[model samples]
Target: MVASIHPSLFDRMVKLRRDLHRHPELSREEHRTTDRLVSELERLGLECQRPLDTGLVAEIPGASDAPTVAIRADIDALPIHEETGLPYASDVPGVMHACGHDAHAAMLVGAAELLMSRPEPPPAPIRLIFQPAEELGIGARSMIEAGVLDGVGAIFGGHVDRHYPTGTVVAVSGPVNASTDGFRISISGQQGHAARPHETVDAVVAGSLIVMAVQTIVSREIDPTHPSVVSIGRFEAGTASNVIAGTAVLSGTIRAQEPAVRAHLHRSISRICESVGQLHEADIQLEIEEGTPPLVNQGPMVEVARRAASEALGPERVRTMVRGANMGGEDFSWYLQEVPGCYVRLGARLADSAGYPAHSSRFQIDEAVLPAGAAWLAEVAVQGGRELATGMVDDLEAAGRAS
Candidate 1:
């Protein structure tokens, strides 16, 4: 059941992907990207709506007003200098589509083209979400607040994965990605000369102790079976070697697959900070900022996505994540919190090069995945729409029987 896309369409998508790669935009600043997407989508006669400042939503009309099936693609780049040195490398310094968002956006546009080329309206409406600020993990929430999901019953989205071959698709049920939250700890202590260190409470020593103690939260406190991480990415203190530092600051991220583990991580960190502060007789403060939640794919939605993948690309091409669940964070999880959805990893691994991870400067994708990804997105929308419409019929019949 491998659907064939026109060669010309694939060529156009490749061109579009290259164009976007050359002019990569950072989060919340995708005005030009938004304009380009609008132009291409409108060319297909789809109505576009600006639900936010940077990102926009486009809709393909259907035969009936059944709940819309949404397909999402993030349209933001990372703050990395391009080193691929391709002719179409990013023109903007310190900003590149190292995460393959350029590919995601172009594939979505390709999907729109395929859907619009169909002879008849689909079984239900389809919404294409070109989201912004995904790297900061705030785009989905903003779009949701702007009512993008008003009529959307089920959503489907995917990221390009370099770990698998280009022809494969990973659609698995259960937690696929971890929740990402940030924390900051500040310590204030008395300062004194090195010769009189006894009179001063050393903030550097206290902060170091706190950092080491926090590691035990994952290793000792939380269940080892449950994957969790507490990493201190930044630690700052002291001005001169001779003086006992009076202040220190620690900042890092917390990640966990389960909500219970996430909460436990926060509590344990706060406790460690307080205990260390009291022991050192210093003022220590801990601040936790919440980010995206864990992305757990619903079983029914996963089935829909798998069916779509099997139909669009052969069943042999469909696969699950060979490595276990990913600890990385994705903002698409926010949508699943409100509606049923599946977030998949589309294989875009390069055959020649040992692939670089998503946030690396040297990362590249197999361009062949563009058409396959577009096909999957299109088929998933159709499959999801049919499933949702059938469920609606089942509900109506059940209600009629009850009456």
Candidate 2:
């Protein structure tokens, strides 16, 4: 299936990917990245529109005015120094395309090129969304606000996963990613000398207890079958070794695959803090910042995506997430809330070295995945568009029969 892509187009996509890698930009600051994409997309005769300050929305008109099937790719970099010694490494200091957004954008551009280069127009309209600020988990929402999904029937998107070997596409039909929420806990206690511990409340001890208590929320309270996480990534307290810390701060992320579980995790955290504070006779406060929702791919959308994957790559190459749902957060889930969409994981694992995780300084992907990923995107958009058109026709026929 990969051999179907022209060698020249593949080379161009590789060049574009490396160029993006060399000059990576952070979220909402993808001006140069956006410019590069516009240049490439416009070169294919696709009319592009800037719906936001740093992202683009372009369309390839179809044979009819059917609702557009949107294909999205995030174009944001991370705050990590490049560790890979490749010649095309990031030139910017303390910034890199650690999460493969460069590849995503390039593949999406390749998909656009392929779609436009076809001899005949697509069966239905296609919308290409080059989005920004996905790392901050708000880009999709902003694009929706800008009317990107106004007439869109279904959307398709994917990420480059280093865990799977290149050529495999995970197009499963259930929960793929979890909701990400952040929390901060503040505990206030009376300050005193370490020798006179009886006279004052120890915030460090209370904070420690709270941390250990929250860990039990998933293990004891929630069902073992359900996937959830409450982790305290940061804890701060105590200015001096001998001084009893009067105040402490703890912050971390909360992830859940179900709404009931998400709410339960939040409630449990608050309950633990309050109970621990009362036990220690200290004041405790907790603040929760809600983030992206759990990304559950609709069954019908997954079927469309799976068929597309099978067509783009062989059926043997189409796979599902071996390990249950991913606990990481994805803002693409925001789009699923408004309309049906499927977000798959494109295998981009490098065969040479044991791959590093996304957001790592040494993260990398197999360039071969670019063409295959682009092909999958193109196929999915066409199939999704056709599905929507067929369903619309069926609905009309049913109405006519009733009348």
Candidate 3:
């Protein structure tokens, strides 16, 4: 029978999660939170190194010299004001851990505690990555730039989802999330009086036309089989009622799962905006800010995660996802871009906490999943270490070639 996680580790995880939820900080600004994590990891006797502006890497040496396995937890919170009525709600106004990074951080720390308690180290070294600025989608990249994965063989992480019960975990092989990119359009025209229709190029009208035309790019230009999203979420124009605004700005985002689709979306958005500007006789300016890439999990690594989750919880509580890629993007994708890795979703919902989404001030996760998450991470480390030691990646590649 699989051993149950210690009771003390479960209690510690709950307390740490609550404390982090209460004193949340924003992206790239997690000073106090970083300090607390450093202390906890050090107490567990892991070799620690702080590389990024507000992040740290803790190394747990194993019994052998196999490739290192890294597990990441984002520590940054969001800018939302707290609305949750819990007694341990965010003490800092205008800042909240509504996205559940606090829970991730606490869970990884609990995993460190459990792993450190074994009589000897496991087969391979374990890297505990406390990443900052994940909400801005740069933490993983920053960590990579700092050589966090210099010798790492694989990585794993999990996000909290309210769609499932607290004991459940959802994961799958291949692309799980989409690439997110942002765009801004500036339309310039001649300002004129509202009553004088023919004298000047009204930017408000031109911008409206451009907005309506932009929608056709997705509906008309792209292939129907490939999923894509282009949302003009924000628009700005005239201030006074009598005068037509000289300029208008439109800002939105693009999301796609495949690289070819992502490139097509970016190219099409620019082409559509420029075409609309020429058609409306307005000077158009376009800017695209690229975000994270799609997270594609390696098939073998995904099986390891599935087994770990099933070992910690019951088999019924662990599932392989069947749905297509999610539009939401993650910085963890940065790590996957360079190495073979798999990221999972841990359910944090209780029966009473339905209808609330992440990043809202009212967001709260079921704390009962704390032990389950920690136990799964520990199991993944154990299994992944063994796989790396046995040359799993090479064997899998050879089998793919033979098949």
Q: Highest TM-score: give the candidate number.
A: 1
Q: Which pairs in model 2 have colliding backbones?
A: none
Tens digits of lDDT, candidate 3, 241-308: 99988899989998887788889888887887777778778898999999998777876889888888
RMSD of 1: 1.4
Better of 1 and 3 by lDDT: 1
Q: 116, model 2: CA deviation in Å?
A: 0.8
TM match of model 2 to true structure: 0.96
Q: Each candidate's TM vs. the true structure?
A: 0.97, 0.96, 0.92
lDDT string for model 1 (1-403, tens) is 1248899999989999999999999999999999999999988888899988898999987777789999999999999999998999999999999999999999999999999998988888999999999999999999999999999999999999989888688999888999999999999999999889899999999999998999899999998999999999999999999999999999999999888899999999999999999999999999999999988997698999999999999999899878877999999999999999999999888876555788999889989999999999999999999998888899999999999
Q: Which stretches in model 2 have alpha-carbon errors above 4 Å?
A: 1-3
Q: What is each predicted model's overall lDDT from 0 to 1?
A: 0.92, 0.93, 0.85
lDDT of 2 at 354: 48
- Model 2 alpha-carbon miss at residue 263, Å: 1.6
- Candidate 3 global TM-score: 0.92
**How accurate locally is residue 289 in candidate 1, as Cα lDDT from 0 to 100?**
96
Model 1: lDDT of residue 338:
96
Q: Tens digit of lDDT per residue, candidate 2, span 86-201?
A: 89999999999999999999999999988988898887899999999999999999999999999998999999998887988998887889999999999999889999999989
